[model samples]
Target: MLSMPLRLRPGDDLRGAIEAVLREHGAAFVLQGIGSLSVARLRFAGRPQPDVLAGDLEILTLAGSVSPDGAHLHMAVADAAGRVSGGHVAPGCIVRTTAELLVALLPGHVFAREHDSGTGYPELSIRPVPQASAS
Candidate 1:
């Protein structure tokens, strides 16, 4: 396991930024830390359009696993008014001030998303990573 601390600058796309890191490793990883954002684009369950929240917002919680192929993350945030909102994380969430994050890399595990008949949505599938043979 490896811990990665990330700080996203202003105007950076939140989800897209994280996706870049996932693509960098192209492996299993999870976000595990608190962060703050000035802007956010969150999509509620079954909602067509994501709500674009503006102004300082405290990142209360972020939970999900990611792979280079895709990511499934949920987030909750508290606005400047202290009104809390949460939903499925989506792209186009531009950062305002900054976004501090701690990403954990699971080198021994592999993650992927596949269309599931039961869920009727792309769901995350996790498994152990294959061992590499000696050269």
Candidate 2:
């Protein structure tokens, strides 16, 4: 695993930015993230639509896995009044100040999303990288 740091500026879409990193690294996991956001789009448990929180929000926690197919991230944030809310991180999480993350890249494996009949949603599929012969 290769660990690297990522920083995002204002107006960056949190999920998209992380997905871009995943695309570059092939497979990676976000160990953690901290930052401020002007807007937060989060989908609560069992909700089809995401709630948009717009204001000075502080990211309390962020962690997830990122594959070339997509990202599955969970995040918690605190509002100006100290109200905390957490849910699945969605797109349009625009940065207010900055977003700093530590990502671990997997070099010997690949991650893909495959539809699972049991869950009725696309799920992560992990596979090992094929070793090449030196002959």
Candidate 3:
């Protein structure tokens, strides 16, 4: 596994920035670490409007996987009031100072998202990446 560290600057959409990295590498990666966000736009499962959280919010937990197809990230953040809220990471989550991230890449596998008839959601479909020919 290769570890990648990223620092997202202000005005960057959280999810979009990360997904850019995944596409840049042209592979799948596992996102792991604790980060901070000045503003959070989280979409709760089944909720119409996203919970727009602002201020110095501590990202308590962040976990997800990014594939060539898309990203599936879940995060929990605590506000200044100590109230914690989280949901599927969405766009418009602008960063404040910065957002630190750690991602791990697995060389052997490729990940893709496909529509699942049962869950009615796009789910990850993991496959073995073909080995490249020797130079």
Query: Once model 1 is optimally superposed onto the true structure by TM-score, how far is the C-alpha of residue 21 displaced, in angstroms?
Result: 1.2
RMSD of 1: 1.9
Q: Tens digits of per-residue lDDT for model 3 on 1-135? A: 788887888778888888887765545555665667888989998987787888888778777888887788888988889999989887777777677888888768888889999989799888887888999
Which regions of candidate 1 fall more than 4 Å away from where they truly are? none
Clashing pairs in 1: none
List ranges where model 2 is wrong by over 4 Å: none
lDDT of each: 0.79, 0.94, 0.80
lDDT of 2: 0.94
- Best of the candidates, TM-score: 2
Candidate 1: tens digits of C-alpha lDDT, residues 1-135: 888888888888878888887775645455654677777789998898888888888888876778878777788999888999999888877777777878888878777788999979888777787788899
What TM-score should be assigned to candidate 2?
0.97
Instruction: Give the worst 10-residue stretch by lDDT in candidate 3.
Output: 24-33
lDDT of model 2 at residue 98? Answer: 99
TM-score of each: 0.87, 0.97, 0.86
Which of 1 and 2 is the better model by lDDT?
Answer: 2
- What ranking of all candidate models by TM-score puts the best one first? 2, 1, 3
